[model samples]
Target chain A: MFGLEKKDARLLILVAVLVAFAPFILNPFPEGSGLAQFNAGYPDLMQRFVIFGIFAIGFNILFGLTGYLSFGHAAFLGVGSYAAMWMMKLLTMNVIPGIVVSVIVAGVFSLAVGWISLRRSGIYFSILTLAFAQMSYSLAYSVLTPLTGGETGLQPKITDPRILDAALAPGATPKANLFGLEMGSSVELGMGSWLFTFNAGYYVAAIVMLVAFYMSIRIFRSPFGMMLRAVKSNQQRLNYTGLNTKPYTLAAFVISGMYAGLAGGLMVAMDTQVGAERMFWTASGEVVLMTILGGVGTLIGPVLGAGAIKYMENILSKINSDILHTWFAFLPDGLEDFVVTLIYPFIGKGWHLTLGLIFMAVVIFLPGGLVEGGQKIAKLFKRKSPVDDSPDGKTTPAE
Target chain B: MGILEVKNVGKRFGGLQALGDVNLSIAENSVHAIIGPNGAGKSTLLNCLVGKLIPDTGSVMFDGQSVLGRKPYEINQMGISRVFQTPEIFGDLSVMENMMIPCFAKRDGSFKPNVFINMLKDREIVERAEHMLEEMNMSDKRHMHAASMSRGDKRRLEIGMCLSQEPRLLLLDEPTAGMARADTNNTIDLLKQIKEERNITIAIIEHDMHVVFSLAERITVLAQGTPLVEDTPDNIKGHPKVREAYLGETQEAA
Candidate 1:
């Protein structure tokens, strides 16, 4: 069946339950515990995890299915953010309008870019998209200062009116309120000394992420997705067989762009700010990294990559030399010092180097990333392994 | 009346002339086979016809309408469908999914954007696809991933994809070029069935003489980017110029 299977439906429900309980799971430390350096319970970073998960998932739709590597996806995110901010400034702070505007604007932008880029295939298409994104980034930084607010970015100001809620002052900050339901408010559950807090905002973002996830699953199952895969495998054959694969590829590109825009809009809703830096090529590269790290074509892979990278960025960076020294105090004083210093380069700003090394290692050895590794391990546990390197029983050409 | 007319089509790549002053007229509902030695511009002519390459000077007409400067998909929408030399089925998708795509394209003029609605419930599209697969004897492999199938099966699935569209004109490029003896025989039988059942004009470029004789009503021999002879398949086999142009040294014996 082209629709979700029973197992898939069950898996989705399990994932939803886990996401709903993320705040409680992450906020496990005692209130004033001195060892509470790794707190992933915060709303800001949780929103980031889900939003970028959406971005990487969208990117995988284009690159994974079509084999068209785009290096300019950040431009879509930036455009979406700007569109969302404009919605906040003009209309209500309600996220519905903001998300709608973001998706529409991003889709239009992707259509224009896809039309020109599709004129050429392979590396030329990649370079063209990169050039377009760079052009957009520069325009946002300088020429379009009024709309983008230049390097300062567009932010909520004290004087901005809150038309939806008159009780709030004109200068007051806008919260993500859905029909008078406060987004920032949390539900606290206590059992003796133990406590758990779940923010309404995180749940909202989680729900949106789930919807995005479901939509992606549907797209992957549709006939349209099949055409995109055909285009990737053999364009000449597709053409000769009477299929015009261009429109199909363009459709995929637009759908992905809309997803990226939705992610950007959610980001702005969570943070109340949109920055020009979001459009940088490095941001674009990060999404690619996430997709590849988890597994490019796999369904749940990008989410894992997003969570892993974001967790490392937030938690691992906080581990200073002092904390390391305390953990290894049982060993000799000088040996502990040597060990901490030895691992110091890989923990903070050096984290990216570790990621790069890991990426290269994965590319060289496990080209299919974590998904393939997991499959291989599963095969090892089972006595009978498949005949070929392909995880599924197919003779597909390697990328 | 010329259902498809190519007038004064000339294509050049820098200094090399791929096609020069080439003209062709396709009668409606006729199976036309274009045969040639290697590098006789057979592929270039097909490319020009399908809007893949723009000729330096030429106009291509389909159903008395200009086909030049139109996008390939737009041309497909105008009742033209193509099948490549190699099988081009979606590797990840099942055989049924591949068939359903062209059925969608045929039923709906453009793509349907209501992605939220489940596609499996669309019984009409499914039934059409099933019928096409049955026509190709591929209904048994409907749930199998296309990439996992044998070469013969893959070709069958691809043919089913094109047939689902129900195009007025079908283009095939070297459809039987790489098949084994058994597969070739199977393909010959498949082509015979397709021509008999579909009632559509098929324009094919084939290196296989067996395939050409199997389905093609008329045959055109090309040499050095020009049509040397166009006649019935039986006449083409006996024609002196076609033998001389295609067989080379064997022309004296003929």
Candidate 2:
């Protein structure tokens, strides 16, 4: 059972199945149809799903269990991407070094920040983290421009010496690879108007995400997780019970930072690009939004939230007036224009408005997030379930 | 030597002296009760003993080590556990989880980052916690949420949690405060049983004379940030000095 409890092991299997078949599930539309634009089975978007999922999962380790809401987590992600980009530039295009370097760099950076920021809890802790992140972003943009490539971003170049990699096939640009397998390599299968892409990059990210999810489950059930939860619940009691809570919390913060770094590294491995804007404060807020919208403390909630937000950003934002006009073409001429105008604000440019409304609804109605919604549904089913032919099939909601 | 010794401990805030020239010695394996009206510095003295407050002058020695400026967790590691006035149990955890935290602290020392180890398989810790729950008669409430329990139950769980750490000295700050008569008597019995069955010292600060007389072997009366008298419980009842200081009676001519 991989050292997991029966319940956790079952959950892992279910997630594995879901993640493995996501390309098929997300691409229900035909390629030539009007709805083809909504397909998320493409390599670029699929890689994003797994990458951001890792980011949110890592954030949950700190914020969910320990109740420390970090507003500067994106700094770690940005630092990670920058590190990965440098690894690819200076070393080989092999992503292992890039990933390893990013995780290590982000861990060290987070340790420094967590050490200082963790001195205070609640609002002060949040402000200190925010300040640290802003400092990192400012440094990356201005002072560290040589290292970070300034506003243009650090990108891989053909002239750089990739010590581990042999001379490339003549006149070819570098791409991230695992051994000899190119990360951008993909296999496209088409049946009639239906098209599905199985990308080597997407699979790598998915496998990494699966491992990260499994590790998160282990942490969630470990005695260490109990201690983290104790830190969240009553740190005073823990301290009095002869436990130093600061170190435990710092470990969580560092772990969360490393997760962000892994996500960042994966992003580069897929797109082979790293931008300073990824480390911006708003980007940090986006991960926070993902974790909260999914469910603050639940294991699968953050991944679900990350996927939801990314999908909305990618798919919903593509709905321009042209798409709206086509949908409303069946209506009368005056009503068709009116409907398109009415729907214009929330799609494309105003997708943030839709996302904001969803975030608010999750916070207000489902404080426990999407996980709580699932639990409520499960509870309802449990209440309605009847006994199986036990002389009398007498089971009502009252029981 | 006393298990806990406080010599001339004084704490001042701006213009007021919260604790002034306070000296106390709690002998090993004895129950000592500190009784005072509000603002008489009983709680202040208790805070000093646990390292929550550092006295401006004087030393607090527990088991021959200076407890001054040590963190509360360090103080607890030296075999002193405190039960708070408001029942400070972890509200987000289950009753069993709450019970096991002190066990982890005691067995693993002050800190260990033992992450990735399955807690469900921790056999020794589980048995110890279950045994403690059985002693507290809370075995049925093991899976219950600690926060959802009644106040009396919370107090019971908190006390049980303190005992599981196996501290040499237990400090109770108004253990029976704000409880109904029935719950108060239950707590009294629990304390009486603990004192008889274990080789542990106890220091209790209380406003209730009933609880003080029931458990205290020696009683110290405080008034205006100083000890007025120290005597046995029986003699402390009608002692004229104690009567005048505690009851606000005018002293008659000697």
Candidate 3:
């Protein structure tokens, strides 16, 4: 319902096409590709892109649409993951049960958190949500260890049940199935030089992600989304106009929580693991970063952001001093060592520094993020020839 | 009997008495104007009527039903809509989308979960909003963002949004609060047009004497949280009590 702009609908279709064949487009330089580690084509990483995309999309419903900054939404994601893991452990080894459980748990959790936190507005509301998330995190780590599995996390063990699938034993060790379909199944294509492996779990995650993305589009175009925006722009006016914005805000919050839950469920389905770390405040902060980095209100922006951040996390961490030395082996011995040493800090743990700088630059220069930047750059080239002769034309603003 | 009635409405915010013994009645399809100085409890009285504040000791009846503790949306559903002092159009939404909201509310009287369906397919709503915008002479700017419009145009859009709901009573809190002379006159003309075209009762709180004198049939003067005088617009301009309470020395010499 997100009043889909004509441009946005076309963008969505383009994104869908890109995601459909990412494996080949992303891995063009297959032989000794330096970007292979950063490739979003791998099933594990692809699952992550979709899952976090769902997470950021949900976060946008509240923070983007309603202008309510929630610092505690990660708790819902973490809770969803834990709930999914529990479903895998106690109910069935199928991802369906995990997904259902995750959604319900997240919905209930958001209802409680939103009810209390929404009582306050602005920073106070943010702080309240933060406090609730921290409480959930603490409880998951220690107080609720029996149910949450504590610091060790709720990993799938040999004793887990698999009710639906007759082939998977009652004591199977972490088997993740979708319905009755095995997630481990994969198809290998092409000769030895060009191998493409298609994993079932990755496709499952992709399908779910697409559904969630479509749902968000609907919400944005709905009358409800309009009301939420009105609440954000002028809450007092809505109150006077005879509309109680509380229920609307709460609905947005709940919808966002469910999205986080779906992401959490898919995460466990891909890896069959859920940890207390998922609910950490930094994880919540990361989703906010994804939405902001991509373009908070833009539907596809968050998905692009999630992929970028995750790629950095995975690939950037692998570029150590040894890898650098391997790349610059032909250089002089001293020069190679110097170059490797210089690049060492920024490659691994220091990658976060680069990300932080990028975030800062975006917030300062491109407050509307990538969307505004792209529009400006497009306008710059589009009008350069005609506007070069006119002073007034150059002064004209895009906004 | 009055279509809407307020009896002995009183409210105190800690040390300040915002309203004290405020009483009024509104007949169906009549324009009622509430005028006062800055701290005259005019807005506080409106807040009480719309259920924004619970009056300490009084009751507000809308269409013969008590609206004292009802929620704002409930009040709206029961046929009352309000326009704020500063225009409160949905800043990001286009002009037409803003108008469609109240129309949806009026048609459904309940929220429908039709996120994917093309909302513009509702011909009735589209026609009604188009006609209302045409009346305001804002039909050309239908697709423009509400935030991009001028201050006067934004007010017109806000009034149109409220009117689209087809409320039985429209409460306006200083609809011409911050407009230039020409813009204020334009707003006055727009309001006069709406009154003539729609069968809706209107209660406006105004600081502008020009706006009040142009449209108000009856005027109630509020001073220090109490009604100084309630009379016809002609009588209100000449009332000695009103001049001392509000117009002060400037109008007295006239």
Instruction: For candidate 3, give the lDDT of residue B211.
Output: 87
- Give the alpha carbon lDDT tens digit for every residue of A281-358 in model 2: 999999999998888777888999999999999999998999998888999999999988888989997999999998
lDDT of 2 by residue, B60-131 (tens): 999999999999999999999999999999887889889988998999987787777788689999999999
- The candidate with the higher TM-score, 1 or 3, is 3
For candidate 2, give the lDDT: 0.89
Number of backbone collisions per candidate: 6, 0, 12
The TM-scores of all predictions, comma-separated, are: 0.86, 0.96, 0.91
Model 1 lDDT per residue over B1-254, tens place: 65788889889999888888787877788899988888899999998877888888978999988888987777887888777788777776667777877777677655554454455667898999888888888877777767889988888788778777887888888988788989988988887888887678889998877788788898888888888888998898888888777855433432
* Models sorted by lDDT, best on top: 2, 3, 1
Tens-digit per-residue lDDT, A1-399, candidate 3: 244556547766777777777766655555456645555566777677778988998998888778898998899999888988888887878898889899999999999999999999899998999899989999989989998889988887775554544545555556788776778777766545555667788788878877788777777766677676667767765665556678888888999989988888888888887788888889988998988887777666778778878878877876777778878999999999998888887788889987888888988897767666775798887876642422110121212
> After TM-score superposition, what is the CA distance of residue A42 in candidate 3 from its true location, in Å?
2.4
The better candidate by lDDT, 1 or 3, is 3
Model 2 alpha-carbon drift over 4 Å, by segment: A384-399, B247-254
Q: What is the TM-score of chain A alone in each candidate?
A: 0.91, 0.95, 0.89
TM-score of 2: 0.96
lDDT of 2 at B235: 90
Worst 10 residues of 1 chain B by lDDT: B245-254
Worst 10 residues of 2 chain A by lDDT: A390-399
List interface RMSDs for the candidates, in order: 4.1, 7.1, 6.3
- DockQ-based CAPRI category assigned to the predicted complex of candidate 2: medium
Q: Which of the two candidates, 1 or 2, achieves a greater lDDT against the reference? A: 2
